[model samples]
Target: MSSRYQQGLGQDASSLSGPVRQRSKQACLPCRRRKRKCDGNLPCNICKGYGYDCEFDNGAQSANLKRPVPSDGSPQPGGKVTRLTYPQEHPKQPTESPFFPGILEPSKARYVGRYSSIAFPLYVGLEVQATKIPRLHSFAYHTGIRKEPPCAVTCEAAQKIPWNTARSLIEVYTATVHPVFGFLDMDQLYVRCEKHWHGQPQDLVFEAMMSGVIAMASLFSGTLDQDTEMWFILHAKEILEDCVISRFPSLEQIAAWTLRTIYMRCTARPHVTWLSSCTVMHLVEAAGLHHASEFVMQTTGNAAPSPEMFNIVNRVARVATSLHILIAFEYGRSIITLNGQILENLHPTTGAKDLTFQLCSLVAAVPTNLSGDALPMMQELFSSLDMITSVTVDHDFLLLLRADLALGIYRRLRVMDSKFQQGHNDRVIAAGTAALPAARRLASQNRPWWNVIGTVFQFACALLVMDTPTSCERLVETMDTLEMIVDHLNTHLAKEALSTARQLVRASLDKKRRGVESLEHIVRDASPDSTVSDTNDHLPQDTAAMSPSLTSQLPLDLDSLWAMEFQLPL
Candidate 1:
């Protein structure tokens, strides 16, 4: 009896209270926010069903269950008290954007659009497929943003496009974009175009690839008709994106993505385009294009390489490398590689001597702080690029590379002779001045084929206009030129870039009028290369001197708007 009593004393008194208790799962964040019941599965059925963020409240203390109070109104020795109650969350009536579901209030809707189909799947896995979707478009059924719209290119429309019209788009691509960046063999693509013109069943991947190429050609053709050019790109995007989700992709898939990536960069979102480019890089590596030498040896150890296989291998390596470099440079950063260095032989070349050397120069010019004059490098680059003046010989990728080169040099010009701070030296200003003719020439040549390309144009124009102490006339002319090209474009991005340019122009004009040394407000207030530009945008300080369109009325009654925005549900 004594031994048993001693043993009982040694055991934990808390454990003696009862058997181990079953833990009640904490409610998911969405369920808690919406006041819905949570089933507590990994996603919590409520969040999984509605497709909301399902993170848990880490701050809420875990509720430990204990033995219930004795039936006789005597509190047990180790009774648990549920102390993790939050203040009765007077549930706020969650307001949604009246105009666009994925969008916020009036101000922010312009850049990111109403909803991000990209953000919806991001919380879920990247490759998670919606197996039970009813609609043809998977995003509609899964994320439930909008109804599945009809395909842009219907069978009827496809039949209606004359073989001649289709042939013309192909011709445009061949004449303008090819010879420099040749992904598809012109002979084979021509044969396919001929076959499609006869109304035969082409491979779906092939059709998508062809659609993208034609769409790209149309944009550069300066035929601003939305129907003929932009429609083809949009239709092809749908088909290609669907192919990415539903089908086993091939080299055609790579080409299809390159088209989409380029279209997105020009027309809409730059960052999304960047991400897509990275995905293309990964896909290229996956397809063994990186090790084509090994691939040839593995398949045909004792035999000479077929011309067909060698050409395919060469094009893929070149396209993948150039696209990766250009995309990285576009976003204003050098490549951040974690793995060991790439093989000396493995690094892809741009194929053209002028482009290849300039590409190397751009890569070498990455260290942002150089004490010496950069004018020689800039001159050398321009001189090198000058060899190919004829647009007839210039490929589309080379054109983009040229603009990108201008963008890099323009950025370098801004950083000239100034320590860390963004200041314009007289020499730099002179360089900026010299760049104006080149910038204008480039804009005229490209005619705003891509979205960010317009921004590049805007940056150049603004720099030139701002560099002058008294060039209001030039600024007006610049605005007119920008409007003539960008204003005609259909995408919201064009307007966004134009607006940025105008703000800088207006701000610079204001600064000149006031005779201020600092261009701080213009730099601080402008949406230069932001992922999302905000609506709480400031008017130029000297707004009274500015145009009526440049100045708008702020709300006279802030309280009312505040009250409406800050209300909570009972």
Candidate 2:
């Protein structure tokens, strides 16, 4: 056998030179080490399933050429090269996973919608085959601030408010909303308001800014009814509409738009808030606020912007970035793309803002295509958030951060094509559980932010989809929080989705109980005393008949839940 094999291997290279054969694509290093077949995709199917970083040996083909010849007098190189060689692994440098090639294609234009994370449940609905989801327009609650006609108007038009009323509103704003964002310098704003109220000349920008502040203050303070609040908001938008927002936007313009976006957020107008947030980004970049130092240096006057101005600029930039990122990352869309590093470099930062920006940067790092390779990054971000000990950061913010991160991770995990769906359920449930307290706190407030209501509902839906014991427990807590938010806010769309999610959870729990009972019955019937031949007869003959309890309790089947339609108004 050895002689015959040797004779067969000794055949001349010319004898094998029929048509030049093409070589197959190279396997990734891990696959080659284990001697497993590889399809050679960016993340090969096997590596992707196992959650291993798929790496290729770029030098392998070249190294094959320099291999030493065999001693058997054949032209072929030495025995096949098997081991993969790599340099010392660096901890700081993560393996660069290939981005989804489709996004990188140069010829195509990318399209991103103006939707926030609050709308993420709709995608979950799609996954569960839920159908006839109402269009976003149907449930939209616009603040009915009529747009003024094209006729030109002076800043004086916005100054028709009673001085006492405006003063009280501004004070309310300075005390409540201003601390969270610090979008305006209260001292500067107060001085300006004093001047404007006394019939002194005021810029359109100042008028617009004052109007926006009053609008939000009225809404936040709850001193006025909804209609009264919308009246103030209308004046603000009218003044803002008059400002000539050129390439170089003024501080007041930035403040005006920022306040508008915040008001829209408080009102729970997701689409409007998204659009306003994008406008803020455009104005921010146009004014060069992202690089505060350079912006100060470029000031045309002998004296640059004051420290107070700089502080406001920095805070507004950070707050605007946060607002836009929260929505963009959740909905997986973007109109303006800001670099994480630019945000990471903001000056005079607070702990909460810094941590929040870091979170934003991490979120921005998530691949647009939702590749499984980003799991390591996602895990690291979540763990880092868990380790946060800064007292300056609001507890509610931290809770929402964890919940949002978990939801993001869950979405990323679902697309991984892994066989074990339960593998990451614990991690997601833990996150959802951690966020429940924050939801309750938000609900207990006079009025929760729109995001609070949306987040609680979405998390409940996510946990309902999970349908595990721990998840269901958390789901109940989440639903309770959602109910609180819905009752307090009285948002019809949330109320509708909340009802559907509750039914789904009930059905899921019932299905689990029935499953447990059926298993117990099988175990009892198959006792040692029972005849083996009779086991089949004793078992339920019709599989369809077994779920009668579930059918009677669950008015709609799983498919019916997906096909359920809603006519809820916006």
Candidate 3:
């Protein structure tokens, strides 16, 4: 064997006198089981390359001389890190280990800016028309370090904000935001709050959870401005820093992170919310909340979570999954992989709750490319969503669900395929038309939902694609709704997106209206009653010039609109 190959295989090539050097017995358990070469690192080269958790056998544990020390330079409690449980020396590095086939290097990780429409593109781009499919970029390892910034207010100070005031904020959050997210067990949160106020021992996670709740409540209640609300948010984050670094995050920690994500959304930080949502999903998996059945089965020790705990877990998991999925769909990338069985376990029996879960599941299944063969499945999903509209009134996010489906259809519709072009066009129009009214109603309510701008803008884009007189009028109406939403927004990316959409729609409307007028003038001059002769033109020269060309451009096609490359951030 060549020297390099022998060295890589952990075999000695220089010493022919000694027995052929065998692979290190100190290889991680995963490497050993898979019969792969290992460099015997804490996380062996092979295990790291395959993105597997590296564990060592008891006999091999002592052979690892390089110990991962805590920040304080003290040995870990056990005097040895085992199975990769010790906190990583460089926490800022990718959370997931590198996979050999699809390496996700830290340098490749990019911040999808607040203004970038790359995530929720007006169309799915050229992927639908290409013969070869593009490789999917996984954000699994693109994790940001979970460090907390210095907070202006401490947890104790936040707790002392007058019980009456605190109670009011919590109640407002429960009534407004809680119905939508439904992650928190209100009773449990109340109990924790009461205990903390009554001189009971403090729990950092619960405190963090309450702080997040207060911050969101403050935003929705209009009791505090963005700056004031941020104090509570910072307080929650400071507490969560400890929770995030813990070996195992608790349900409370997950709830706190979920709330933080929700707050970020309300403040119109889509990119930040995406990153935060990802962090929450990771915490969900860390808590083993994703695999419901398996989590309960795998519980150790005499203490198992109560039935209430199970319900809370399911609720949090459902919301976290839905939120992550929603953002992932927009970005065209995701880290979590949930299935129907897990969703079924998380779904509530009926009402708006059940409907929300159903919508999430349907959206998760939407294919990136809309081919003729995929129509049946898309139709079924669309049908399911339509049925949902009939049974339930739109709530905190129902409008968004509808808009997203319409946008998905618009993005992936294959206009060139004559075989399915008509079918494709029909689907986009119907979905857009259906979502328009819902978007109007949601915006008319004057509630500043985090997703309202994106949802309303999406419906408008879909209508613009139809390029019909009626669609234009509806698009105008949608723009009016967007105007109201933007007025309420606090100068965020969402506001800018809606403004951009409105401008494009207005320009398109003007061009279409001009085309109709030009056509009308030409028809008027050509009427039978007209005294003008065919050879001599009584009409103005410019009017005559417009007649021939105006007919071709009468119905504004998406060709020019597409050429502009107008993209709005979600």
Candidate 4:
């Protein structure tokens, strides 16, 4: 029976060892658990079921589990070991990875198409079915359809964008024309400005446009890059030039509006920026209405006449003139010519006389040490005084202009006396003479009390030019006349008269000091060819120190008369 049992075990073992039958019975255990073929052996059925390596024991009982086996099927020196591998199964769609569930969904992995014929993978480790996605083709088509190549939208999730971005964009559009759309966006900005009108836009539109102006100015001033600056300048120049030509009638209003907005921007709380002021100056200067005539023409539709327009024009001109005169004075240049032109153009009907006087004061405030071209300009300015005498309106304003003009002439004469002892040019002297009749006539009228102050100051300046000491006696007589005028003004127009009288008195004192110094200088540097004898000369002792009665017969002091003082009535 034992023999029979041993024989049975041996037969079973022999059957397992047979190649074809063993292959059939010892199929992979992993394959069997997966309901597929499996090879059965010592570790066959159970190892395969657990997805572990199946090993066959030859002679070795203990094996090194740490060292991985080679796959070549060669017996290793220490032990015979073999590596087994199965073919990897791949999902049809690359996005179908179990690691990233739902990644393959059409909504999540929609493709953004490319225009080029070359196909690139949308993602790094995944293969996309490009044939199935229509969005990819649509993206390519749209991108290719753009006339100008589209720039990729950069992520701007950082700082606030500058306000000038819109202006810069418009500038870019204007400079570079796209194939599909040529400055379509820029045209909108242009049209908006062109259509804006008084009362129509109201505050809302004004605010919007003002914002745009600030932005454009910032862009043009090169707060941006060079390309942006170039673009803005080119487009801005074109727009402004066009506005100048086509919108000539509205130019003044527009300019005024722009200027007003800039002014507000400059003074706004917190302030805009440093470069904004420069931009404002640039815009104002570029408008080309700095001159009075241009200002009048621009503000008023008719260049012939318009009192209201003239008044506005006068104000604007005065402001601009004052600004320029301030600049010239600060830089040590002559402002006399500018003052002269402003005075000559003062309109009787438009109340510009005060403006004229203000500008004259501004000119006078400049240092008188200027020479050469500045001196000549002052001389020319003195010559234009003849026009003030003929003005027939606004006597108070005229008086102010005359007083200021007289003061200016006196200051110039003082400078000339100190520098050029040879005396002023014949033409300027003649012009002064021609202006005297008008001054005398205006002075004759009952005018503002300040007129007397101007008159007395004028007489004082003229007295210095007298060739004889007797003229000083005559000046004392004139002082009596001035005192009477002052008394009359103090009684009737005291309030308005004091300030002007005080100014005149100060000027007279200055003139006295200047005259004494000038006389001393003349005596010290007396040239043989000079007409008047040196102050040391007693003027021919036999001639007698003439009394006021004797000197009163002499001609009036025309060179020092304040003509405009009488031109503007009280």
Which one wins by TM-score: 1 or 3? Answer: 3
Error of 3 at 111 (Å): 29
Error of 2 at 535 (Å): 18
For model 1, give the 10-residue run with minimal summed lDDT: 80-89
Winner by lDDT between candidate 4 and candidate 2:
2
Superposed by TM-score, candidate 4 places the C-alpha of residue 366 at a distance from the truth, in angstroms, of 13
The number of the candidate with the highest lDDT is: 3
- Candidate 3 — what's its lDDT? 0.55
Runs of candidate 1 exceeding 4 Å displacement: 1-160, 222-231, 242-249, 292-304, 307-309, 332-403, 409-447, 451-499, 512-570
Query: How far in Å is the alpha carbon of 166 misplaced in model 1?
Result: 0.6
Please give the CA lDDT of all the candidate structures. 0.46, 0.54, 0.55, 0.35
Give RMSD to native, each candidate: 27.1, 25.3, 19.3, 37.1
Q: Positional deviation of 244 in candidate 4, in angstroms?
A: 30
Q: Cα RMSD (Å) between model 3 and the true structure?
A: 19.3
Question: Which residue pairs in candidate 3 have backbone atoms (N, alpha carbon, C) closer than 3 angstroms, thus clashing?
Answer: none
**TM per prediction:** 0.47, 0.57, 0.57, 0.25
**What lDDT does model 4 reach?**
0.35
lDDT of 3 by residue, 1-570 (tens): 011111222322233112332345466787666555555656654454334688887767777635432221111111111111112122332233121222111111111211224322211321133333222233343475765444333447344476777778889888877766776768657766766677774556677788888888887777767676777888777777652334336666777888888788767456777899889877766554443221121101111233344456566777777777667666656546643434554445454455545554554454433335666755644554444333433454665565565465455433322233444555555555555565556555555566667777776776776676666667766777777676755466757887689688788879989999999998877868575455325434554545444435544445753564433459
**Each candidate's clash count:** 5, 5, 0, 20
- Give every collision pair in model 1: 102-114, 102-115, 103-114, 266-450, 266-451
